[model samples]
Target chain A: MKYSILASTLLLAGGVAVLSGCSQVQEPAGICNMSAIAAQRQLAAAPSRVQGGESPLLEMPLNSVSITDYSVINKLYVRTVNARRTPTGTVEVYAQIINCTDFPLNAEARTQFYDAGQAPSEPISAWKRFNLPARTSNTYQTQSIGTQSAAFYMVELRETK
Target chain B: MRRARALPLLVLASAFSLSACQTVQNTAGTPTQYLDPGSSGVVRGVGIEGQDIRSMSDEMMRDLLTVPALANASISPNVIVDAEYFQNESSSRINKNIITDRLRVDLNRASRGRMQFVGRQYADMVQSERNLNQAGVVSGGTIARTAGQLAGDYRLGGRITSIDARDPRSGMIERTHQITFEMVNLQNGQIIWSNYYDLRKAAQDDIIYR
Candidate 1:
């Protein structure tokens, strides 16, 4: 009887030990690291030259020209002289057109003048359209009219509608 | 009385033996929560290849585009970019084309500028023509100038440098990536803007583990 009682007690104790080993808990998945993304966004928001500066052409005489009954579109001015000549005459007159808001300005938009006059009386000269490069500036010269040169020449700036 | 006394002693001895047996059996079975405490797994080496370096560099380039120098430019401006020169001083090998392509895409998206492929394409064509001449194929450079040429007022150029080193005590590895981008006046070659970014990552294991 005593031996049987001992065997029962041992069996109970073994069952308890086995059951205790079965209880366990697991952890969940972790979050992804986003430090890189945050850093990139901060960099994007940092100030740059384009955002802080005024228009590069604001100080030039061209800025003084009034847009009278004319819409301002795209504008480009380039200074090119006949380098072959000894006393290089800086051709200052640039082509101007009244309406360019509807279409893109091309090389054909430059105006040509034969003589110094408001009206196109004789087709002695032709104006050629110019395109400006990004992040750079171009300078255009005005026609030299004897001793009294026009302070400013009008160039049509094309606007893309 | 003797039987009663022996009964408790026998029960105690049996209980001790049973607990020991259960402990051994529990250890032999599959562990539910914990890994094997006695196993010291083999430490593996990390392998960073040329492509991995290129990928990391590309990602860094994309991140760098957010810098104001490239971001503040008007979207419709013309842009020209010279091919990047890759000079590798580190022990790791990397592809130059990967860096160039990344820069191209990043700048294009950031500035809304058009790229003129003519200069590089022309140079390539001329070089190829020369090669063809040596091989006896007669060809002249007759490509007409197209209106869509990437002739921007500004030109962007830059370089990439990388460094990788291992820690002696902890055995941790670190990688450093650096890139510098500069925008210059196309006509005058004057640098108008410049910026650079550096990125570093440290990993406990040199190699990625699954």
Candidate 2:
């Protein structure tokens, strides 16, 4: 009788161990370490389906204006994003972001320019910090230093870290 | 039952004794790693940093490209960019060459055939080489040599100034750095192009900028 009781206890412990491991398996590695490019590709593949709330989506073609931090999806919104060729023959990227929250927000953004072949045409831009007043909008703009005729750009936004 | 109760006491006593023992990790010292100079890394300070140098240079280069007087001149204008005229009036201990060199190099690369950069910093080396060739000690290679060194149409001049403040009670340090860049016409002493970058930073932990 005692041996049976001990076996039952051991069985219960084993079951608890297996259940704990299964619960942990659901939490995959964090997306924070992933590169902006890879994150954009992954997000483009399987977009969110939540109703009434819009997740941070690529605003422009070739995945421009990506919010790197997932926490800021609801806190910030990209109102407009555009790219154009300057008179000097270089490309310039501009994005207007809206603050969704009542509190002031500070975010850092950087840009990477690519050529027609989808290769880096110029060095990545330094992180530029912009402040957004509560419920207001702010614009972030950067110009490419490349003399290349055709260029594409990706701008990444994240909370000041 | 008694032994089991005593076991907990013994383990607690042993743990207390062992807590005083110092231990060393098995791994080697911190490994050298590379970080992007264009982005903020672990070490940061209130003064100007690598990212500032990169961004200011890049901005200047792009803005200069838009100016027709320089980038769209009838003939490629020879510009001299050196640390001779770039002054660091700020208290920060930084090598001025780091900023001017980057600006000159980036401008030269992106300018394509629109502009020219004269190496005023290396005039002595060029002069020595020319002397050797002229003295018949060395042969002048393929391309025909020019008469003399080219004169610069515009020379880059800039100043880095700062306003520093410290809160006596809170021990907070605030610094505002204003970097001004300009291109001057050598003959008429006219400021053809000018731009300035301003940044203000506050921090509590004192970081010595070397």
Q: Evaluated with DockQ, which candidate comes out highest?
A: 2
TM-score of chain B of each: 0.45, 0.87
Q: What digit string (tens of lDDT, one per residue) describes model 2 on residues B63-174?
A: 8887778877899999999999999999788899999999999999888878889999999999999999899999948868999988999999999999999999999999
lDDT of each: 0.42, 0.81
- Measured with C-alpha atoms, the lDDT of residue A80 in candidate 2 is 77
Q: Considering summed lDDT, which 10 consecutive residues are worst modelled in model 1 chain B? A: B35-44
lDDT string for model 1 (B1-210, tens) is 999999999999999999887744445675566522211124433333333333343333333333333343344334455454334444444455555565565445433332322245365676665677657786455775343434566666766666878889998887776666666767788876665545455667756433
Interface RMSD in Å per candidate, to 1 decimal?
27.0, 2.1
Docking class of 1: incorrect
The top-ranked prediction according to TM-score is: 2
TM-score of 2: 0.74
Residue B186, candidate 1: Cα error in Å is 4.4
| Structure candidate 2, residue pairs in collision | none
Candidate 2 lDDT, tens digit per residue, A114-137?
Answer: 778767777777787778878788
